[model samples]
Target: MNFDPQTLRYDERGLIPAIAQDAENGDVLMMAWMNADAVARTLQTRRVTYWSRSRQAFWVKGESSGHVQHLVDMRVDCDRDCLLVLVDQTGPACHTNRRSCFYTALRDGAEVEIMAPVADPD
Candidate 1:
């Protein structure tokens, strides 16, 4: 059975949550929103693409930062409301330059910075 992007459940806004993860180590990289078109583009191009809620536009990962995410696999949740993207992440996945967007850890009711921003290569 061929998978279709429209078959996946989307919110009223026609968006779905997509979680990107490191294909090798299984580390979660980041979470972003994706419309059906974004999903099709990601699958077609093998580059992870997202819908920026704030910008209200298509956001292709690493388009500007060079931190590209090459899609290895895409999985839909059982509820068909979420996506898991296994990818080859090149650089910092967070806009803050951290390896992942989930940098803050709530430990014992206190927020802790577990990851630091990646230094610019040059």
Candidate 2:
């Protein structure tokens, strides 16, 4: 069956949450927002694209930094309000140069640094 982006649920701002995960390791890389257009673009181009709420624009993963995320697959949640993007992540997925944006963990009511930022490339 064919997929349709309009069938997915979106927030008042016409946005939905999207999570990026490592296709091989299953490690979650980052979470971002996507509008219908971004979703369509990602599927059409096979490149992960996200809606930047702050910038109010479309952010194609690794467009500038070369930390590109090549879309392996895209999944819609049961509620159709969220997305899971399996990707071949190139470099750090976080602005801090970390592999994943989920670097902090709340354990036992304490915040802990789970992963350090990736060192800058030479």
Candidate 3:
């Protein structure tokens, strides 16, 4: 059966959560939102694209940062409310320059930095 982006469940805003994972390492990199258009764009372009709720616009990964995420595969959750995107990621995935956005760990009721930011690309 052919896949349809519209078939996936979306919130009232027509958005769904998308998780990015490292294709080679199986490490979760980040989570973002995606509208149907963004989903189509990502599939068509083979590049991960997301909807920026804050900016109210389409955000193509690495558009300015050069930390692009090339889509290796895309998966839909059982409920179809979320997506898993396996990708070949370049550079850091977090705005803080860490390899992943989930760099903090909650241990013993305290937050601990589990990973350091990547060195400046320059």
How many angstroms is residue 69 displaced in model 2 relative to the true structure, after the best TM-score fit? 0.5
Model number with the top TM-score: 3
* Candidates 1 and 3, the one with greater lDDT: 3
For 11-84, candidate 3 gives per-residue lDDT tens digits of: 99999999999999999999999999999999999989999999999999999999999999999989999999
Task: Report clashes for each candidate as comma-separated counts.
Answer: 0, 0, 0
Candidates in order: C-alpha RMSD to true structure? 1.2, 1.4, 1.2
Query: Using Cα atoms with residue i matched to residue i, what is each candidate's TM-score against the true structure?
Result: 0.96, 0.94, 0.96
Model 2 segments beyond 4 Å from truth?
A: none
- The model with the greatest lDDT is 3
Alpha carbon lDDT at 79, candidate 3: 100
lDDT of each: 0.95, 0.94, 0.96
TM-score pick, better of 1 and 2: 1
Report the C-alpha lDDT of model 1 over 1-122, residue by residue, as the tens digit.
25689998999999999999999999898999999999999999999999999999999999998999999999999999999999999989999999999999999999999999999888
Weakest ten-residue segment in model 3 by summed lDDT: 1-10
Error of 1 at 71 (Å): 0.1
